[model samples]
Every structure is written in C-alpha cells, then in structure tokens.
Target: MVSTLSRRTLLGGAVALGATGLLAACGRGGSPTSAQPGSGAWTFTDDTGATVTLDARPTRIAGLNDAIASLWNYGVTPVASFGFTGLADDVNFRGKDLTRVTEVGTTYGEIDIEALVAQQPELIVTHAYPKDSSGTLDPQKPLYGFADLKQQQTVAGIAPIVTIAMSGSAADVVERTVEFAQSIGVSQEALEQPRRDYDAARERLRAATASGLSVMAVAAYPGEGVYIAKAPDDPALLSYTELGLNYPDPGGSDYYWQQVSWENILDHRTDVVLYSLRAMSGADMQQQPTFAQLPAAEAGQVFPWEFSAMDYVAQARTINNLAEHLEGSRKVT
Candidate 1:
C-alpha cells in the first residue's frame, strides 16, 4: 500500500559500478537440491561470495520489489518485499497475486524489519550495487536497496541473503535472478510460454531500433536537475544498444549519470525520451516550464522507463512497449 519513488539508487548518481561476478552468481541452482525440494540440503553462493546453506530448501522467501517481481514470472512469490516494486502500475509484476506479500520497505533504505521478521522467511534475495546515494558506505555498499551496509546486515541476520548483480548486462541480471528463482523450486514447465514471449519481444525490439529513433534515458529531480544515463554503463540501456538502438550521447563522468540543470537539458538531444517513472509521471515532467520547450517533450516523445524488474514476462512487456514507442516516434531533435 505504501508505493514510493524508485529505489533505483543504482542509477541515481555518478558512481561507476565497473562489473560484477554475474557468472559466479549464475553458478547455482543445484538440480538435486532445488528440484527435489526438502528431500536434500540446499545451498547457493550469491554475488557477494557468501554461501547460504540450509537444512532444506527455503519455502518462505523475502526479496526486494524488483527481485520479487522477477521471481513472480517463474511463479515464485515472496512472503515479504521492499523497495518501489509497484511504480509502473504493477506492469512488471506480471499479473502475479501480491496481496499476501508483506511490503517490508516501501521506499529505499528504510525497512520495516519487524514486519519482515514476522513473515519468518528462510531466505532473502535482492540485487547488489557498489554504493547508494548515501555516502556512508564509502567505496562500496554492495547490497542494492537497503539504506547502508548496516541495514542490509541487520536484514541478513534475520534471514540469509542471496544477491545478484544490479550493475551488469540485462542478460546477466536476468539470468542471476532466474537462477535464484529456479533454485527455489520454480517449475520449468511454467517457463515455456515466457521463453516464447521473450524471444518474440526481443526480436520486435531489435526491429524497432531500426526506426532510427534517437532516445535518451533520464531521471529528473524537480528542483535539482536531470541525471542522464551513460548507455554502456546501464544494464537495460546497454541491452537496447546491443540490440541496435541509437541512443543519443549519454553524458556523465562518474560512470552512469551526468547531472545537468534544466538550462542544459537540450545538451542530450533525442527524438524520444525514456524517462524514469521513479521521479514523477511523464505528465508532470512535461509540465516543467523549461522541459516543455524541449523538442521531444513538445513532440510528446516521452516514455516511462520503469526501472528493471528482470523477469521474462515483465521484461518482454517493457521491450514491447518501447518498441511500440520507437516504431511510432518522429525525430524531433
């Protein structure tokens, strides 16, 4: 019930998250253990290099919003969730029934630890970023959504935590999340239709990129400015680029975002704008005094970039919607 802005602190600043051990994170989901359920012991080595061992497969699970939404595609729902998971009209939720899931942390950094503990989850899964907007963690925080390392550790103490990379390629992020889902007794039978949908959607996206639309991704803070993504550094944007999307120059030095005032918003010109829903609605961004003068904004070329949910169903939806936008856009810049 407590929906909030994006906890996508991953793209909030100039911090460069070089790369992560995504393959190592995927090197899990022991078939015997995961497939057989409680018949044998279960163990998973997360991106942080920690091996969480359990006497039996963990049945009750808790996770960050995006992680849980991703798991839902494989029919694995969490008992508790944190972060801004429902920002995009729950489209990333893939029609999964989340009524029973407890909202642990509605925004970022602030977790209702007591509510999470009440769920008695056996395992907690979330993404890992090098640091957050908060400078408290110094060089690295690793855990993605929690306020800092201490909060993440406090939650970890309640239930063993498993992490996947939040700063790698979309495929790597999706794979790690899927592996986590598979490790927790997801039905391979349930994956068939999604596989077909994903393949179709990806091809559609590749084709739509041929529309020659120059798109720029950004998250705007009303009073401050806008943080535009450096395409190669962002997981989803990189994936789109790899699929042949022509994104305008994504300016930034700290690795991901280049903070620019409204006066300089035109520096990153594009035919279409992939704005994050975390900041505000597209309508609100359109209402900005100076933002209204931008060519794409005036041309009604803005689209919601609902940060990643990493699930096949959700990802396919994002791909298809973007493809539709690309196919319909006119180069206003």
Candidate 2:
C-alpha cells in the first residue's frame, strides 16, 4: 500500500477525512498556546478522548487542510493548515479559503516550525490514525502530515494538540468535527443549514442506490498495478453503504486496499467505479490494460474518490452528485 502513497495525495498516513468555512477569533494573550491570562473558557474532548483546555477559545489555530475543509463549512476557520502551499485552483477545496490561511507545512513530511510559530496558534488541530490505513508504514504516528511521533511532539511544544480520528462513518467523523467547531465558538445556527442540506443529500443517495449499481473503488498505478479499496477500511465507503450504496467488500488482509496486477483487475465485477484521480487520472486509467474492458469504464461510470475533504456540505454535494450521475447510469456489470 505504501507503493501507492504519493506526497501530493491525502493518502499520506490518512485520507478518510474533510469540510469548509472561516471564523475569526484569537487565543490567550495572542500566544500560540496559552490561557487567557486567567479566564480559561475553552475546553473540548476530542474524538481520541483527549480533553484540551485553554484560557479563551482558541481564535488562532493551526491544523491539517483536511479538517480545514470541514471547519470552513461552519465558518470556523483556522490561522493555517500545515500542508497548505496556497494553490487556489479548484480541485474542490469545499470553501477552505486558502487566501486567508497561512501555509505552515510546505512539504509532505515536514512542517515549517517557524511558520507555525508565526501564526501564534493557541491550539493545533489535526487528523490522527492509530493505525496506518495502508498498513505498510509505522502505525504509531499520532498525527497526519508530520514525520513521526517525535515530530508530533515537537509541534505540540508550540501549542496544545487535539486530534480528530479519521476512522468510522464519514458522517460521524464530520459531526465530530462539527462538535469541535462548536466548542471553539462556531454557532449551532451556522451548522443547521448545512445539516439540513446533508440530510437531503442522503435521501437522494438512498433513492439512487435503489437502482442497484454494483460499485467499486480503486487506485491505479503505472507499474505497480491497481489497488482495489477494501470497504471495511474506508469511512466513506462504510458511510455510503448505510446510504444504500452497493459497494462490494474487496477483501484483503491489508488495512485498506487489495493490490491486483493490471490484468488481474478483470476478475472483479463492477457497474460503476470511484477511481482515485490522485493515483492516475481518469483518462489514463481508461487506457490501462484489462481495466478498460470493465463495464464501469466502458459505460463512463467512473467517478473520483474524494472523501478527503468531508465537511457535511461537501459530502452532501458528493452524495447528490453520485445520485445525479445514476440518472445516466445503467446496469453494465
């Protein structure tokens, strides 16, 4: 699975994550992390079961871009995203306005400590996976993007760290993020509209999935062959299954994907596919041997696997998008 991980992709340690919006607030004495001289109004218990307390709710925060996408939907913006380098070109940031956010980590394995220090974040929020979904790397990395445990510890020195777990239902993960945002000062009023839209989207997906399209998710590599997503390891797939999606369990011992040779992909049955564009573009995958002959490809039922930015509105759009696509889809498997 490590063979498929590229620095440019969210598959770096994690991916089952996301959402968007901006909120302006400042932390204690304007420090990267501190109490509000004495008031201490901020405290939250994260998904990882860690409680974070601060003087005033952290106004200046630094975090992973994936979470930023979700918070952006609620207008609870961060001061910076550790992995951002400011490319506003639309790959669907889901309203994570990069223009107002600082880029603290310029590379995949490194965070710019100096840049993070400059942001004066009272708290640091990021995604954490106790086990590497890919199963090839160290499973102990407490946070995504940072190099290792020591690196995570190093960053924590600048500000208190809170982690959002990336495992489970995408909806559950997103709502957990919503709860976090609310704790940090985002109003329930700001979240209700998105919540309504998300609920509507789910109904649309439920209706679409009734058409019975056999679906699969995959990542194709040039020489390493194709990787079929193992549904049990994907929060997006898990959640969608509840929405009535017919995604099969592409079984494997690995944590997330089952690797098959180019020719071997023919053994799998699918009517529609959610391909990882980061692994290879749709045009390229269409040209691959054996893969091209699949019913999903021939019928143009391929879609991008984009659970990376999972705010409620963003996912609502994604759910509605697939439902819309099903309007043109047929049973080709």
**Which candidate wins on lDDT?**
1
lDDT of 2 by residue, 201-297 (tens): 9899889999988888787777878788866566677788888888887776766667888888888879988777556777899888588898889
Q: How close is candidate 1 to the true structure, as a TM-score?
A: 0.84
**Candidate 1: stretches off by over 4 Å:** 1-7, 10-39, 85-91, 131-142
Q: Cα RMSDs of all predictions?
A: 5.1, 6.6
Model 1 lDDT tens row, 114-198:
9999999999887655432221122343366676657777887999887765655686677667777778878778887897898
Using all chains and alpha carbons, the TM-scores for the candidates as numbered come to 0.84, 0.85
lDDT of each: 0.70, 0.68
**Native-vs-model 2 lDDT?**
0.68
